[model samples]
Target: MKENIALFLAILYLIYRYKTYKNVNKIIEDRIENVHRSFFKRIQDVLQCSKEDAEKVGLALDKYFVPLKSKFYKIDNNTYSFVDEGGFKGSFSIDQNYNLLTLEYNGVDLLALH
Candidate 1:
């Protein structure tokens, strides 16, 4: 029947839309995970704290400064920079081995790269 065919097509369209939505969500999640994982690991190593503790500090900073989720820059092979959605901004550079080399937060150089 014509109605049966139309129903099947509509269902297929819905399924396609759902899958697209899921894929977009996954991409956004992966980007956030990458930003947090590498940057937070550097913070943890430099501060010499447990992963949990470093995460706490990172979360606090995010809460306070409100980083712009979509604004990211690759400073080098191992370093990245980001800007806050609000007033604060910061940047960090890592070494060849992925160690924290420098950190700059809110116009203050927190660490020296060399």
Candidate 2:
């Protein structure tokens, strides 16, 4: 009857919504992983350090450079400058390939450090 059809349609809608939500979450996770990898690579290259060292620095920096809590300004299409209330300041840029092109802290250029 019409009541049965309505119930079936509602179930289908719920299933569709669940799948969409799952897919969105997966995309966000992948993007976060990518960012982490890119940051580690940049740190390693700039600091001329090993993976372990880069990871250590990255973890420490994360405490101050959190994007959500920092005040940020868009510098260009793929670049942004940020300052945390605690006095940490930096800028970063990512290329189309998700490679980090630039990273700086407190007016010191990471790429030119060593």
Candidate 3:
């Protein structure tokens, strides 16, 4: 009887561990999705380009610069700035509705270029 109880407890513990693992994975996936929607989707909308182009520009900025942390800063209620590790800089502005008004890279309009 004792051996049977032990086996049942072990099975319950495994089930609990599996559920916890799945929950953690789900949380991680949600966070990643949020980042993508907030960052990359915003870029795509502002640039008026495909998702691939926006991602290419984002990845290029990260990889082309020196191996350091890139950063974004809110310049105003509607504008944000980006600075790469290698001293490259860009900025974008959005309206109250969060629609992108303008995007510039190195003082040039990225939308026009795109």
lDDT of each: 0.64, 0.68, 0.64
TM-score of 1: 0.41
lDDT of 3 by residue, 1-114 (tens): 999999999999999999999999999889657654455665555456577765654454333331224456667666777776778888767655445467776777766664
Clashes of each: 0, 0, 0
Q: Candidates 2 and 3: which is better by TM-score? A: 3
Lowest-sum lDDT 10-residue window in model 2: 63-72
Q: Point out where model 1 deviates above 4 Å.
A: 1-10, 66-114
Pick the winner on lDDT between candidates 1 and 2: 2
| List of clashing residue pairs for candidate 3 | none
Residue-wise C-alpha lDDT for candidate 1, range 1-114, written one tens digit per residue: 999999999999999999999999999889769887765675566545678765665554454443524244566555656675664667766544444556677787765422
Rank all candidate structures by their TM-score, best first, as comma-separated numbers: 1, 3, 2
Worst window of 10 by summed lDDT in candidate 3: 61-70
Residues 1-81, candidate 2: write the lDDT tens digits: 999999999999999999999999999889757777677666555555578765665554564454434455567676766
Error of 1 at 11 (Å): 3.0
Using lDDT, give the best candidate's number.
2
